[model samples]
Target: MNKKKIIANIVKVISWIFVLVFFYWAIKNNMLSHIYEEPDKFLRLLKQHVTIVFVSGLAAIFTAIPLGILLTRPKFRKGEWLFVNIANLGQTIPSLAILALAMGFLGIGIKAAIIALYVFSVLPILQNTIAGLDSVDKQTIDAARGMGFTPVQILWKIEMPQASFFIFAGIRTALVINIGTAALAYLIGGGGLGVWVFTGIQLFDNSFLLSGAIPITILAIAIDYLCRGLEYLVVPKGLRLARKTNG
Candidate 1:
């Protein structure tokens, strides 16, 4: 059909082909045999990894979104810069260092890992929410106010809908980051796929390393694609149409 659609189809085909090739290589080389041998243990580690990522991401979303919104309000506007810097500090610090500090205060366990992951993952969502809300058209907001809409009603009905795209983009970024970082949770005695990876490192076993790494890479990519689909669903239809037309 059209050039853009044709290019998109080609890209999609190539992506699937690549995935199939990678899996075939893994199987042919027996890179995943270790995983297959202990299917239950592998599954349990996968579950733990998924749980850590999901819980940390959920916590970040709940805290950051509301705080981001509050920062945009008149009462908190003056402190926006302060809070943004604090969030930035979290990103600037190494995740390992964060975990170490957390261990001292919160002890070494899943709790520390979750706290560290949550801290590390907050900035993207927080910044994006603020940016999205701030970017809403002034004219639209004024129009809403003129229609006798309360501030809360205007925000809920108008601003938030417009900002959903940026917010979701932030969330997608945070989730991907959290997934990668969760691999380090095993360092804190938090069980996950990282257990296999670290054990491989200790024993100098390539297969064990691949067993953990391959699944993590796959999970991250899958979750990213899932979030992309979610972005389409959550972002308003009108906004999507407008974006397409503008592009």
Candidate 2:
């Protein structure tokens, strides 16, 4: 195998090892027992929280896409730095603080958590999208113009197709972050996997924590791999060739 293949394999092995070790620690600590004892409650929490994740994920995507487009536009040159700084600031804010602030108005449950997670998740997707759009070559833009493509046509037919990989990469990151943060929703009674972890921590029930943590970690990994597959499908052939050549 080539050096790059070896490196990829090593990374995969390390990831698997990390996951397995964490799972073992949680299980040995009996983190999942509470949820196991009452299957019905566990199911209810899962149902309640899944909706929160979906809502939060959608909110982040909606906010990010438009902001990303606006930030990447040439006309908005002066505003770009300000927007990037604000997005970066969003990443720095503590999730707990965001949740606390939202709870006063939203009154707890998944709604508050959804708002917090959605807001926090936007930065990655937005930044990636802007960068991706900016990365498209100026020569390509000129060629598209020469070919009689309108601004919309150029964006949809040329730029967006090339930038798709970056956008999807951002989404993949957001999805994983969403899954992990969904657990924190339990703090406000949003009742997802975090309910198990939090309850287990409070009651010293290793089983409870393990049940929640294990499933979430697994789900995140599964979704990440699935998104990578989707990214491969969507990425343009030229980009793929370029990547291969660069490697």
Candidate 3:
């Protein structure tokens, strides 16, 4: 099997192990009892959590990718360093701190929490997009130019295809981190599965904690897997094979 396949299999095995452990722990401690008893409450928080992550993640993707593309262009190259450093600075700030800062400006709400998450997520996707496009072989681009391919054609057909994997990798990493960070949004009254998590903490109820926490873990993993599927469908077959061989 290829390196990619080997790595994927290993990840799958590891994910399953964690899932089984979560279930075993849940059963042993009755951590999921509250979820069964309060199905509506659990589902409501689940929906809220999903909404927060989805909105922020989507915003990050939309904003960062285009900005990354612009920064990579010859006209914008001079300003790239400044913008990149700014994005990197977002990563330096603690997640909770960012949320709190947003709260200070916007007041306590889902909107503030989402803005913070978007800020946090932008760096990875931006960095990856820039890196991906940069890593595309210069010779290949030049060859395309020599072949009379328009700048737009070269960008869409050649550059984007080569860069897509890295872009997706960034998105997956960002969204997973976002999921974990989102749990902290509860502290700011942003409301999510974090509500249950903090409720457990305050009340010392393990059931509430596990019920809220494990689903977040599962959601992050599911998102990572979904992005992988997108990579398979959106990235070209030739690119996939080439990356596997090179990887």
Candidate 4:
């Protein structure tokens, strides 16, 4: 393997090790005692927060993919630039401000926080998905057309397959960022790891902070590795060969 791949692999290994160590340390330090103290409340809190995360993640994808598809297409697909700009502006909006704004209607909780993370996560996935689809070989697209493929077929069968790696890369980036941002949600009374972190700070409990921080970091690393595997799986063999040759 090349030097870049070797280094990437080493970093991945170290990341997982760090996660394991941090999680163990948090457990040993009794950072998780609060959950055990009130199992029902703890379970409810975790479930609610996880639901928010999943919903936010999906929201990001929904807002992202349509814009991505439009922007990546060769011709203007009706308000393409407008859609792209709107998504771009979503990213530009500060998360704190968004959360506060959401609080006006949604109240302070997972709903508001999910809106914040969803907004933050949308741009990268959208931009990368568009870029990835656009990056596909033009000749390959032409060949598909010559084979009598419709626009829809070209998109699903040809474009998406080629774009999978970049799309997944965007997802990987979004996941890592969301894991960290999930902590911020605690300020608005959203659950998840952020609850511990924020509560720890307020109560002068380092263990609570560590408990939150460690799990988040581990989740981020795990998602990153999983994305890498998907990237490997979806990246076209021809592209890999070309990369190898160029390297």
Candidate 5:
């Protein structure tokens, strides 16, 4: 294996070990006592949290990917900057402020929080989609053109296949970011694990704090690994081999 692969495996091993140790410690110290006492509440919040993440993430993916494709077209290229800046606004503006604004327009609830998250996620995915499309080796496309491939065919069979990795990277990053930020959903009564986290802050209780915090951390890590695996599986093996060799 290459040095990068070795180092990555080592990191993964260490991460899993840390996760195991952390969970054991939490259980041993009774930090999870409250979670056990209210299993139903825990499950409900988990479902809400996962639902919020999944819905927002899916929306961002659909919106950004198509918009990115539209922006990359030759006719639309000049206007791409406008959309990029618009998307950047989502990132530049504070998430809490976005949520507040959403509350005014959409009202406070899961919908508001989901909109805030969708906005936050759009930038990275959109930027990456543009980037991934741009990264398709021009020479490769030129050769396809030489062979009589239509623009549409070249995009689906050439550009997209090659750009998959970078696009997935953006998705993975956004999802992980979403998982962490979802904790704030509680502030607006969106109902997620954040409830306990902020409540613990109000009451100054470690157990309550950990009950939410630990799960968020674990959820982020788990989602990241899942995305990473999906990236590997979805990207062509030839690309993986080429990347491995290049790395």
Candidate 6:
């Protein structure tokens, strides 16, 4: 009923319309001819790509969130800058270079790709978790302490809940980045949609290129929307209402 809601609805409608149109164009032009010719291969590659993204994302989340929390604690605060800079270095390097390094040390396969993706995907989640925890209201923390809540209790009950939205935002970003970067896995003999893309380029076939490219684009967009919905669902209702009102 509100202006923002109306605009969001309109944007959603247009996005679906665009996807539908693109799909129709691809089908009409036989852009997926290569995919249809070997459905099994396409399916296998799709599964591999999704698996890499999912596994690497989980790795990043588990590693980064705990490290971020630890860095915020008094005993670990001094090392925060060191860890943050190391994470930042991961992002600063080219993804292809990371994959190459993985290939050099870990060999050419899923193991190497997973290691590279995990490293590349970690920084955003780590940074966001730290920022989210840091942004929690000091007054709220003080009040919790006054109520005799233990440090752990305050973190679990107050800090994490307040920071959940920001944390999820970071995750969403990491997911999108992972989806895009996972394409490079094919270069290291880690099967993914990149196989089709590179093959298309090597063969000079537009159909092969679109076959891979379109699906990656769709997957990223779909996951992005899914994460956006999850963010709304998981964030406290009061916080959601406040955000809407403030916006």
Model 1, residue 95: displacement in angstroms?
A: 1.0
Tens digit of per-residue lDDT, candidate 2, span 79-145: 9788878877667988887888778789978789888888778888988898889889989999999
lDDT of each candidate versus the true structure: 0.92, 0.82, 0.91, 0.79, 0.92, 0.92
**Residues 42-113 of candidate 4: C-alpha lDDT, one tens digit per residue:** 566556656766788888888787778877666865666677788776668777777788777799878888
Distance from true position, residue 45, model 2, in Å?
1.9
Writing each residue's lDDT as its tens digit, candidate 1 over 149-182 gives 9999988999899999999999999999888899
TM-score of predicted structure 4: 0.83
The runs of at least 3 residues in candidate 4 whose Cα sits more than 4 Å from the true structure, single-residue gaps closed, are 10-28, 35-39, 77-80, 226-247
* Error in Å for residue 156 of model 1: 0.9
Between the candidate structures 3 and 6, which one is better when assessed by lDDT?
6
Using lDDT as the yardstick, the better of models 4 and 6 is 6
Question: In each prediction, how many residue pairs overlap at the backbone (N, C-alpha, C within less than 3 A)?
Answer: 0, 12, 0, 0, 0, 0
Model 6 agreement with the true structure over 1-247: per-residue lDDT tens digits: 7888899999989998988998999999999997889899999999999999999999999999999999999899999999999999779999999999999999999889889999998999999999999999999999999999999999999998888888999999999999989999999999899999888999999999999988898899899999999998888899889877887
TM-score of each: 0.92, 0.89, 0.93, 0.83, 0.94, 0.92
Residue 138 C-alpha lDDT in model 2: 88
Q: Across residues 21-78, which tens digit of lDDT does each residue of candidate 5 receive?
A: 9899989999977788999999999899998899999999999999999899999999
lDDT of 5: 0.92
